[model samples]
Target: MSLPSYQKAAVIEGTELVIKKNAFIPSFEKNEVLVKVIAASVNPTDWKHIDYGSGKTQGSVSGCDYAGIIVSMGEEVEAKGDLNLGDHVYGVVHGSSLERRNNGAFAEFVAASPLVLIKAAKPLKTIAKGQENIPSGPVETFEGASTLGVALTTIAITFSYYFKFDFSKKPLEDDFLLIWGGSSSVGQIALQFAKIYGIKVIVVASAKNHHHLKSLGADHLVDYHDADAVEQIKALGKNHIKFGFDTISLPQTNQKVHSAVSENATTNSLLPFNPKDLEDYRSDVDITVTLAYLAWGKNTKVPFPWMETDENGAAVSNPGFPEACKTFFKVASKALNEGSVKHIPITVLPKGLNSLNEAFDLLRHDKISSGKLTVRIEDSA
Candidate 1:
């Protein structure tokens, strides 16, 4: 198949998104693959980059999660035999990145590192005509597959590496895992992963989402609006929560989650927060921040200024994160294939690339909740 020289993309222009019909089709590096993007999803970071990322470059594509087919690959990727041309895969790219300006998932085609990509167990099933939303289930559509990349990578690194969960042993009856922001994409996926590992899950989400979250494996649910939410989590888990993940990761949510877990619990946050800010909260808990972009195994600058960086402003690389992503992709793939893991529910947007501006607006104002917003590439035409 002949590849196009240019493609339509949602490009960043100084804190705003512009749909560009003549964006260059990015070329792949030796360790990367060029994907023909089928569908792409909006993430909080997508809007955050435009809103708060001072380092973001103009003309960079503006999205992260994508589901697509491998249209081309470099020699190294082809030789590795792990990924191949025409394989259906879902993964993330550093969208609106300051360094890799042109490579982002919101375009018709993307140059993405293969290390963080996950091959779909089966071919993507097309969404029926006029269908706007896909209910949660095994990943059978590109929209559903598009939501898994960032969420899965975060969970993989958090559970397998940072938290050091021993999946080999059966979870004890008293073992518990606490997830704040349970209705968010990452929190929803984490609930299923914990259930598969036999750990009890206490998730904090709106009461209205409890029925859906419970179906996804949440053992207990506490509404974050309640004044005694932390106490409720503590009571339900009996103070035996061994692991905690804060998908919201704001200082207040972090403090609440910190207080709800066991005294010596290992906790992770999606966003970086200073331990000093939480000095009065607890001293014995272990807290680490997980940035999914590190799974690319590249030295890059993080958008947040508070994060640790080198003299050059590049965030420190985690040498083991890429390997951890590869390892966890295998586990997640197996679960997805066996129908044990379900993708987050998704709402497909209209007019494809043109809808990205609206998507970003929704994300920017926190209008989207309990599901993801996605766009199909073919619809852009």
Candidate 2:
């Protein structure tokens, strides 16, 4: 069980972590798992946390998603359930665990909580349920599976309650929904999820990404390029739409959502569905969509099942979030294995132990989008 002296790892090294070589590889608790990272993907949270302290701090690393082979697992963890030594796996972290206090996935090996790392085989179980189009094979390579983490949070955290979406049905002539930043990683998956949920989507995003949104099944696309993006949106609703998710968390996005759902919304805003507070009666439409911001103040202004807050000023857990995550990953795994979703075509840059910085530079310039960047570190099998 000898280890290399200098494994590849992307280190934040300090505030504004600029990737450098010689970062550390983390060790695990008894039940913890050590992943020989196969292909780690850079997500927005990865950069934001590195640049902005948006996630719980470890020491240097700030990435969160990875796909790879398991080299080690805590004794208790191995005895507890399904994970086996040498198994390939992928998952997202809880964001606040000290085990990962500043440790993120931008490295060759990450010691992660067993709870966060689901056995890769689980998602493949859905094929037997008659979910056609899913391949009857191991879930495709890591990046394809790597992108599922944030998408899982968006769906599980923000829209689990609304999962009752009857995709087979059509929206009424006046039904509407406000989707902020439809082009984002989280928004993309949510749109795909929403398609199954039956919402008439009015998506907000940069004009260039509108086509991508349309491909994901957005009903209407609003270019955020214009100063009056919200105004344009509200006019389309003529004030009828309510319900939204602010994946972007921008000040303007907040206002746009408030307007799109508040102006002329016809769903009883006064009584309040979850009944937390009331006064500004968009009274017609009680529900307004907002992404549960982990960085902002809690929104108790209007009530719906989705709103929640924790002591850390983060959105409290949604009731069905964990389950939704499990389900979506299962779906994503199936899609990946079966080829329903194509991996964003790109080079598999398995750069061993020193390429972490290179990955970060590419991400910083917005050089990677729609395509994935990856790294591999172990031959556990």
**lDDT (10s digit) by residue, model 2, range 1-381:** 566655555555454444445656676678578877665556655555555553334355656667767887789877886677777777664331233443456666777655435456543211121221221123455645655554554454455434233334566656676777776666766666666556677888888878767876889999888988868887776655756666665544554565567544422111113322333334444453323222112222111223455554434544354454445555555544455443333334544334555666787787754444544443111
lDDT of each: 0.86, 0.54
List model 1 lDDT by residue over 163-234, tens digit each: 776566677889899999999999999889888888999999999899999999888899999999988988
- Top lDDT hit: 1
Supply candidate 2's per-residue lDDT for 256.
Answer: 51
| Every model's TM-score | 0.96, 0.66
TM-score of 2: 0.66
CA displacement after TM-score superposition, residue 262 of candidate 1 (Å): 1.1
TM-score, cand. 1 = 0.96
